[model samples]
Target: MARNPERRNALLDAAIEVLTDEGARGLTFRAVDARAGTPTGTASNYFADRDALLAQTATRVNERMVPDPEHVASLMAAEPSRELIVHLMRDLVRRMTAERSGYLAMLELRLEATRRPALREELNRTVREQYDGNLQFHLASGLPGDADAMRVLYLAMTGLLVEHFTLPEMLSDTPEALDELVAVTVERIFPAA
Candidate 1:
């Protein structure tokens, strides 16, 4: 197996783009190599098989989607309140929207997981870990939310993102719609503090 970190990352990144544009069915070693601008068989050298490529692509997409530490720290500097919760969620929507391809790639991975047990287990574990970490962060931040509240917020925000990305026409086109949605979600989830 190739041990070049940069090359591996490039291949994985290219895999993400392929997943975004082509979905799981269209993903192939040739497609990845072409997308990465590498020689034929280059992706196979880095990835053992298509499943490996898909698994690693999921990890890479998760890496790209996480919020920056600096940005999180900056937001944490302010007092936690319902309004702050709304702000945090809005920031999340903005970040996810900005990294549109990565988010879409993740969704593709989720869909692919349905047919692959190994991939399904891997995704389930990763999602659970993420949820646990998010719950911890919410508790530590004093963000005016409990575990139940956090769970609800996560589901609501995920639904909003899915609609925003996959079916934009289903929601209002007005610029304020997203903000209002986030605000209302937070308001309903967290009591006045």
Candidate 2:
């Protein structure tokens, strides 16, 4: 049975708020209900289980943060220049930093998914899609089509994001340091002439 659009949107919005403010572990049907200003039973009626609710929330968050593959491809195709690449990296960092709570909640969801095989499979699929999308961009950028290099770049970007939020002090207290770090990482992945 299909859910009412208004209720579904409300639930997703509430889930994002609850997950960001309270962490994924803190998410509960009652909390979502209160956040949505809907009846307590509404969440259960829609989600059926905690895992289902989390899966939906993860999908929602990804939809907002990660650009669609087609859009990324178009950007890559339009200008494969180093300047554009650096701009993309900086933009990504700024966005992730601004949404630290959501980023943390995503990390929590990944950890929890590891313990659940079904969730793990779904998470892995999503990751592969992201990887492919990134690889496509790199290929479009005239970079050497090295799968291993792309994988390394992807992992490094993920690590940098996690560290930026979880251990900002380690990177130093200056924006210059962050910019330098991004530049160095970009050069390593796509060396400048």
Candidate 3:
């Protein structure tokens, strides 16, 4: 395995692009090397095998999608109310949409997980951990939502993101429309505090 963390990150980022553009079937060491503009076999030097590459790529996608720490702190500083939930949801949507390739790569990972048990386990662990962390944060911050509300909000927001990414034409892509969607989702999920 390569000891250069930067080069390894570059390979993982390239893997993300390859996953987004070519889907899991086309994810290969050669493809990642080509995408990274590194010499042939470069990816192989860093990753043990395709499964290793795929698993690490899933981690990379989550890393790319992590929200800015300062932004999250600022949002948490505000009083926990339904409006605050709106702000948080909007921020999530913005981050996920802005990192479109990462999200698409994740979707590719989900499809690939259906066929690969190891990848499926990896994906499940990461996704569940993320959900638990978010739920914990919401509860600790005194956000006006129970676990059920959080669950419903998760489903609604995920549906919005999927529709936005997969069929942009189906939903109005305007910022105002998106903001409204987030606002409405929060209102419906949390009720008036």
Worst 10 residues of 1 by lDDT: 167-176
lDDT head-to-head 1 vs 2, winner: 1
lDDT of 1: 0.90
Ranking by TM-score: 3, 1, 2
Tell me the whole-model lDDT of each prediction, alpha carbons only.
0.90, 0.76, 0.92
For every model shown, the clashing-pair count is 0, 0, 0
- Candidate 2, residue 4: lDDT: 92
Superposed model 1: Cα runs more than 4 Å off: none
Residue 160, model 1: lDDT of 90
> Candidate 3 — number of clashing residue pairs?
0
Models 1 onward score TM values of 0.97, 0.84, 0.97
lDDT of 3 by residue, 1-193 (tens): 7899999999999999999999999999999999999999999999999999999999999999988889899888988888889998999988998999999999999999999999999999999999999999898888887899999999999999898889876775688898897898789888885
* Tens digits of lDDT, candidate 2, 70-170: 75566566445666667677767877776665677778778878787777777788767877887775776675536776687678788888888779888
The list of candidate 3 runs beyond 4 A from truth reads none
CA shift of 192, model 3, Å: 1.1
- Candidate 1, 1-193: lDDT as tens digits: 9999999999989998998899999899999999999999999999999988888888888888888999999998999888889889999988998999998998999999999998998889888888899999999888897899999999999999998899877874654897888888889988786
Candidate 1 TM-score to native: 0.97
